[model samples]
Target chain A: AQSVTQLDSHVSVSEGTPVLLRCNYSSSYSPSLFWYVQHPNKGLQLLLKYTSAATLVKGINGFEAEFKKSETSFHLTKPSAHMSDAAEYFCVVSDLTGGANNLFFGTGTRLTVIP
Target chain B: GAGVSQSPSNKVTEKGKDVELRCDPISGHTALYWYRQRLGQGLEFLIYFQGNSAPDKSGLPSDRFSAERTGESVSTLTIQRTQQEDSAVYLCASRPGGGDNQPQHFGDGTRLSIL
Candidate 1:
């Protein structure tokens, strides 16, 4: 079985400050990880993905995440938070155990940016 | 359309009624997925369709939850005897087939409310 756990349910950061959202996963196979953002009344948008090529993955809107196999962590980070970054973030892992390539998602982290 | 599209952006129905949600995937995409999102929870995988192969229905919560996809184009999810717990945002996603690394493109989703 594959599962993901988001460490924070809610995170608040001020504009121009750094942002970090932590996630951990348990997968039987080499995992493909992804980070997606969903704004209010909007569909989910992909932020970044890690598919074993690189440990550090850069995504759109100045966001990035590092896949740390040793720590079983894939933490999303942004050097400077923007007001537009306020949204719900989810960590996902691909599951191939039952011969079905489905996704297992975390509970999600709600980001609140303060002006 | 250039992206995945879902119909009936919002639907409110009485308990015990059956509701159907539709999805139109991007052209040339062969893989489609359905997910459910409760008020503040993460996305729950409902079903998946990849080309003409048997769909991975492992994620469907119960027998009442059913879905169908025609070829590689449109898909429909039907919920029978809708209950209050079934009230959630039904999201649809699609991606090009042949690989598991591709990020799934999402739709705006349909908000279903059961009264």
Candidate 2:
């Protein structure tokens, strides 16, 4: 069984402040984690992924995430938030257990940026 | 590489009607996936096709949802007797073979609204 949890449904941050979006997962095997960002009327864009590679993975737009095995967490973070970062973010875990093409998504966290 | 493409970007259907969504994946991608995202919900897995084998329909909401893939190219998802609750954004994604970093290339999605 595989599941992903997005601890926060919404996060509000002022522009230029640090951004944090938490996610936790439960998987019996080594998990494949992913972060995806979706803007209104846009398709999902892959932010980052962790597949037993380096614990910390960097993605586009200066966003990054750390895969902590012990904590079962893969939280996404950015040194600073930009107005363009206001969107819905999803954390996903593959159901493959070790295979491919099956993803279990988090409920999603909506990020709001204030000027 | 050209991204995945889905047609009929918007669909409005009356209850009890049927609708079909089309998807064309990238040239060399062998894994295709279907997912549903409601207004306030995360993505819900629908089905997956790997190569020319039988599709994994485990995540399908119900038998009313069915999908087919011809060769490794295009796929179609069919919804019979659509219900108001079935309205959502339908997404199609494709991955390169079974690689771990095979990021899922997504289509813009079809917005289906049931009236």
Candidate 3:
């Protein structure tokens, strides 16, 4: 079984400041990880994914995440937070060998960017 | 459509009523998935379909929740005898073909309010 956990329920940051959202996972096999962002009343959009190619993955809107195997972590980070970056972010995991092709999502972290 | 499309952007129904949510995957994409997001909660996988293979319904919460995908294009999620607890935002996603590491594109989703 594979599962993801978002450590923070909410994270508030001022515009122009750095942002971080913590996530951890447990998987029996090597896992495929992803970070998705959802704006209010909008569809979930893929921010980035880690499929074993790179440990440091960059995504759109200046977002990035580093996959640390030893820590079982894939925390999302932004060098500078923007007001428009306020949204709900989910960390997802999928098994590497399962034919199910389904993803397991975390509870999510709501980012609040202050102007 | 350039992206996944979902119908009935918003639906309000009373308890014991049945609801059907529809999803149209992107043209040429062969994988479809259904997920439910409750208020302040993470997304829960409902089902997945790939090509002509039988859907994986392992994540469905109950027998009342069911889904069907015609080939790899259109999919419908049906809830029989919906309850207040069934209120949620139903999300549909699709990817080009099927693989372990493919990133899924999502629709805006249908907000179902069961009263």
Candidate 4:
């Protein structure tokens, strides 16, 4: 079984301020993790992914996430929040065992960037 | 051509009506996935297809939801007896092959409204 949990349902930050969205996961096998963003009326976009590569992964629009194996967390962060960064963020996990294509998604965190 | 494409960007249907959503994956990609996102919620995995093998439908909420894929190309999701709770954005994504690390490309999705 594989699952992910987004600790916060919502996160608010001022433009130019730092932001952080927390996530955790549970998988029986070596897991592949991903972060995705979706703006209103748009499709989901891949932000970044972790597949046992580098623990620290950088993503588009100046976003980044760190995979903490000990903590079972892959939290997204940014140095500055832009108005465009205000969107829904999901943390997903996929178990690599047997090459399954299923991706378990977190409930998501709605980021609100105030200008 | 450059990315995944979905048809009928939006659909409005009455209760008990059936709806079909189409998706064209990136050329040569052999892995396709379907997910649903309800208003103000995170994405829910529905199904996945890898090559010509049997699809994994474990995530589908109910029997009313069904999907089909032809070879490694186009795919369709059909919802029968649509209910108000079925109103959501249906997302289609495709990944190159079944590699555990391959990233999935997503389409803008079809927004379905049930009345």
Best by lDDT: 1
The residue ranges of model 4 lying beyond 4 angstroms of the native Cα positions read none
Across A14-107, the per-residue lDDT of candidate 4 in tens digits comes to 9999999999999888788899998898888999999998999998989999999889999999998899999999888877664465567899
lDDT of each model, Cα atoms only?
A: 0.92, 0.90, 0.91, 0.90
Mark the regions of model 3 whose C-alpha exceeds 4 Å error after superposition. Answer: A98-101
- Every candidate's DockQ is 0.69, 0.57, 0.75, 0.69
The C-alpha interface RMSD of every prediction is 1.5, 2.3, 1.4, 1.5
**Native contacts recovered by model 1:** 0.66
Worst 10 residues of 3 chain A by lDDT: A94-103
My TM-score estimates for the predictions, one after another, are 0.95, 0.94, 0.94, 0.94
Worst 10 residues of 1 chain B by lDDT: B95-104
Model 3: per-residue Cα lDDT over B1-115, one tens digit each: 4899998999999999999999999998898999898887788888989899888998899999999988868999999999999999999999886776888899999999998
| Quality of model 2 by C-alpha lDDT | 0.90
State the DockQ, from 0 to 1, for candidate 1: 0.69
